[model samples]
Target: MTPKQRRLARRLRQLRVNSGTSLEAAANHLGCKQPKITKIEVCQLGARPDEVRMLCELYGAGRATVESMVTLARTAKTRGWYQVYDESANPENIDFVELETDAVAVSNFEIDLIPGLLQTEDYARAVFKAGLPDISADIIDQRVELRIARRQRVLDGDLSVWAVVTEAALIRAVGGRDVHLAQLTRLLEVATLPNVQFQIIPTRAGEYMAMGVPFWCFRFDDNYGTVALDHLSGTTFLEEEGDVERYRLAFQHLCSTALSKQDSLALLRKYIKEEHSEWERRS
Candidate 1:
């Protein structure tokens, strides 16, 4: 999920939680049941255009603020039809759908899945399968396609991205032998691009991923940096000044531990060579 959706979900949740608004009160105002209000507030349910309008009025969100949110929620829904695939497609992914393609500088720390912005179809499919173990086959494929498509947008678009990958990511082999091989090659392909930077934090570097999973920190031309945490429930974006500063420091620590660009490329190249050699030996 991009940071925006995380921010929206987080903001709405905070407002309700802080304002001491009861489900019955908000629901009563919206003419919907308490469960509906709960879903909207928690971002579990996709917000309708009119529902957003109504909720903003009930929440006493300011006139301009309400308009901006209504627009954001509408943008959240217009998803170019092809966006149906991402497994993380919730308020977070949707909220940032329109903004990410416009970002100038982006950095990510991937503890588990490929940086969402850089994943290949097979790798994405494998990740999605693990996340939605019970999903039907057709839906899984659609979602995988969507995820790969999103990654391609970042890779192919005019965005500059720096991704720091934990060593565990390289070793886990998300999609089995063939899938792993393809994903590794895909990384090598994108790593060659001028606007993209990729680094692998090897196990020898150790202790980082084990100590805590990685999160992404995004910086936009708006002169703000956002820290996002992805959870099983989806993603949350941190906006508090202290929280944002802490993430900046965390990213700097991670950057210091990650492999240098030249060495990181060599490591990936070596992995590719080893993969084919092992494949040839087995054959």
Candidate 2:
């Protein structure tokens, strides 16, 4: 289940508890089996919009909360846009995308490459090629398209993003000089968006916390959030309170140590100029 669905399940369970309604009572009120209520509460089953509305009425929930639950129910039943690439995409990756789509805010710390939501098409293609050298070209193309499609979230102005990227990520030429320069230019363009922010962690900031791996923290309107850790083998989603808090603090530290937004933009421009000079020399 996506984080949104899990959050909705938690809310449903909490509402029942607050109203002193037993599982049997809720099931009876909804005219469903007890196991059905349990499944819905645990996110094993999706609740219908009408069912959510009825439960809210039964629990005497406020208008805002009721509407929110109904919206979550509807969203839970809908398929994610990433489903189109289901054959090529990992299930966990699809789940992460679903959570990202519903997130109100996202915080990412990248050590190796730019986050998928911020990467340019060429840079993304290069990363995919390097990471999955054994994979078929057709599969890589599908992944690249999926990565590019994720950028629409920012373009639509529905999500706010704050990214802390390492200096090495900027310095490394993922798709040769011209492509790398273009990628930097793209970063500068997106950084100007009202909802997007970037911080560059210089090579000088050595031996810092969160240097071991890249991770993304997502925040929702319901105050529940999750952390996704990128590993060589696969991505791991962390939802435990302690794990999430640790990553959150690590991200905070990275932001504090990294360059300010203005300085980060300046740094990107510097890289672009250097790359352009190198490209000119080679040409």
Candidate 3:
């Protein structure tokens, strides 16, 4: 479920609890089955706007809260922009996009490559090519475009981001010297955004808590949050409080071990200059 849907579900459950409305009672009041109520409250099913209104009214929710929840329900039912690309795309990837769209804050830790949100066009293409070499060119292009579109969150200044990347990711040279130079320069530009913070875990910071793990933690308006862990098969989205807390604590440790934002920028600049000199030498 998307963050908005989760928030709506949480709100509905909270209102029902506060009003002491049993699931059976709530379902009877709404002319629905008890399982349907359970589904809506757990975000396994999307609630219609009218359903939200009726539930809020039944739970004695205030007018402002009812309207807010109704709006949330409508949003939860709406399809995200990423859905326009291809319905056949991986469902987990689509879910991540939806979560990212609704997130107010994001924390990312990358080990092997730059985070997709920070990747430049050429750099993204190279990464996609390496991962999906057997795929058709058209599909690869589509994936690259989708990745570029994800950067809208940063460009639109709607989301606050804290990204920590390993030094190896910065110096990997994914698309050769030219692409690496552009990527480094792009990172420098992206880091200047008011809501973006970039840090680097030095190569020397060995034996860390998240050595091989690359994950992202998204924070919504409420205290609710989700974590996405990358694996060989696919991504894993963790919503359990215990799982989220562990990832959050891991991220905190990463932040402390990583170089400061200013120092990271300096490192980026140093690499950028070195890459430029190498390109000049080759030419």
Candidate 4:
């Protein structure tokens, strides 16, 4: 099922239960069979906007809630924005992008690289080149374009972002010193946005919780959350309550151990200068 459909399905089911309604009753109200209602709630069948509105009304949802669910139901039937990059994008990455579209906020922890949503075009291109050397340049270009589009949401203030990175990641010259410095400068600029927050874990911090793991927690206003763990193989999304909670807690701990927002920006400036100086010296 699509992300929006899944979200709508889950919320519809919850609303039914909260209203003390049974599947049989819901089906009867819709003049359908129980299996049909079950399929709608399971996302095996799409829910029409009228159906969603009716269901929400039956579930005692307010006018606003009904309209919201109805809108989601309508959008769930449309194509996702990332469909254009299907040929070049990883399946896992596409899935993450789909889910990210509906996310109200994102909290990401990076162990050795800048978070994807905060990366500059050059930095992201360098990363794709280094990580996926087997792919063609055309494919890499497509991926880079996709990354830039994803990054735009953060810039447009459509999505709030909280990012935590290790000092090592900031120090590593991913795309050479010039690209690294540019990336750092971009980070400082992005950090100034009210919707974006950045924290850095200094190398001196030593050991901490989830020491070697990196993950992203996406929170939605619908009371659902997802944690994405990116690996060499693919990205794994955890939606179960326990798994999401664990990652959420881990991110909180990481934030607490990392430098404050102001300090992080200060450290980022320091690195930009150091990288620029090193580049000039070698030149």
Candidate 5:
């Protein structure tokens, strides 16, 4: 299912539960089996606009809410632009790209590397090559190209981004000195964007909150949100209210522990100067 379908499915489930309606009752109202309702709620089946309106009405939703959901139902089946890269992406990564594309705002915390949306081509290529050693070079190139396209779509849209990276990321010098320098330059450029909030957790912070993993929380219209955790095995998306809330709190704490946006930019500048000076001396 597309991200829109996922959100709509979730919203429908919430509405039903809040109204004290059973799946059997919902199925009866729609003149379908309980499994159909289950499938709709789980995003295995797309809810038609009429069905969405009917369900909303049954759930005692306000007229405005009904209209809003019906509209989402109408558009939920549309394919995202990222589907073009389906051949190169795994199912989880494809879902992530869909969510990222649809999100109005994004909060990202990276532990040891630059956020993909803020990474340069050389930097992203290096990351893919390092992480997927067994994958064919062609696949790696496709992933890198997809990353660049994803970045452009998000930045070019009205998306608001708050990204926090560890100081380690800036100092690691990925893809050697030249690529690292260019990546930092790209980050500085992105940081200056009005819609982007960039911060860094200094190494001096010494074992801070969210020390173990990196995650992204996506905020969408209608106040729905989703959290994504990427691990070695695959990407996991969390939509449960409790899980989303926990990640949100963790992200908030991370932001508090990070350097302010202004200081983060200054830190980037400091690193860039050091890299340039080292390059000059070597040359």
Candidate 6:
């Protein structure tokens, strides 16, 4: 099993253990055998929404808190947004991806490249190459294929995206001519979709709560929200109310300073046209 699967298993175990509760005691709370609890804690089987709710209640989680976990379990089988990397990206913590995919709406405050969920295959590859210079060429190619496949996930889900992008991401040149053009084209196409709303926040707008923090905040049914923050090791999921609230406020502030959706699309078009013009001059 992968680290993610191990983590989910461990988290459930720790929640009980940390409460100074025994397996049998927790099992009684859920009206299940100790072995059943063990199976889920070992990631041997996926937990059902009702069972997950029982576990949360046994752990002393509040109604709002337990409801969130229930929703997570309910939507844990949804298709991943990173379908492009389906073959390459591991399916260890696939439950997390499923939760994001089923989210009714997503709010994002991005400082660099577009949010991964909003990226096209070409744009995703371009960004990946910039940081993963040591990755093998064959591996990079696979990664690109994965990202392209992932981009199509929005079409498969009842997903709505509200995004705020920093001006720097727009100006940065990545993946060379064809790649960048393709990326911009993809963005335009995505923007035209009925559920998507995107805007650009020029650096001149100044800073707010997201002055330096960038995260993908996904909102699900039953008021469940997950904020994934980039870190040195990997991604960290924030469940604490304070952390989630901070991200929500930061996103609101970023949106306050960003261009309106219509103007933002126009800006993207202008940027793309100018870049192509410059490419022709250089060629």
Per-model TM-score, in order, reads: 0.67, 0.85, 0.85, 0.90, 0.90, 0.71
- Write one digit per residue (lDDT tens) for candidate 4, span 1-283: 6667777887899799889999999999998999999998778998889998999999999887788788889998665878998889877888789888878999999988999999999999999999998999999999999999998899999999999999988888899877888888988899889999999999999999988888999988665688888889998888766788898999899999999999989889988888888889899
- Note the Cα lDDT for every prediction shown: 0.70, 0.86, 0.87, 0.89, 0.89, 0.71
Give the alpha carbon lDDT tens digit for every residue of 21-96 in model 3.
Answer: 9999999999988999999888899889999899999999888878877887888866678987764357777888
Tens digits of lDDT, candidate 2, 1-283? 6666777887788789889999999999999899999999888998889999999889988888788789988887566677898999888878888888878999999886877889998899999999889999999999999888889989778899999999998888889987888888998899889999999999987878877678999987766678998777888888755677788899999999999999999998998888888889999
- Give the residue spans of candidate 5 off by over 4 A: 1-3, 20-39, 60-68, 281-283
Error of 2 at 224 (Å): 2.1
Q: Higher-lDDT candidate among 1 and 4?
A: 4
Q: Could you tell me how far off, in angstroms, the CA of residue 181 lies in candidate 4 after the best superposition?
A: 1.1
* Candidate number achieving the greatest lDDT relative to the actual structure: 5
What tens-digit string does per-residue lDDT give for candidate 1 at 134-253? 878787777666665557656665678888887667667788789888888888888878888888888788576324656766665434556667778777766665787787777777
Better by TM-score, candidate 4 or 2: 4
Off by over 4 Å in 1: 1-88, 96-99
Tally clashing residue pairs in candidate 3.
0
**Candidate 6 ranges with C-alpha deviation above 4 Å:** 1-87, 90-98
* Number of backbone-clashing residue pairs for each candidate, in the order shown: 2, 0, 0, 0, 0, 5
lDDT score for candidate 2 against the true structure: 0.86
**Candidate 3: clashing pairs of residues:** none
User: What is candidate 5's lDDT per residue for 1-283, written digit by digit as tens?
Assistant: 6777889999999999999999999999999999999999988888899999999999999888888899888878776777888889898888898888778899999988999988999999999999999999998999999999888855785788899999998988889878999999989999899889999999999887788789999987666789999999999899987899898999999989999999999999999999899878988
Q: Compute the lDDT of residue 88 as modeled in candidate 6.
A: 52
Better of 1 and 6 by TM-score: 6
Q: Order the candidates by lDDT, highest first — what do you get?
A: 5, 4, 3, 2, 6, 1
Report the C-alpha displacement of residue 9, candidate 4, in angstroms: 1.8
Pick out the ten consecutive residues of candidate 5 with the lowest summed lDDT.
150-159
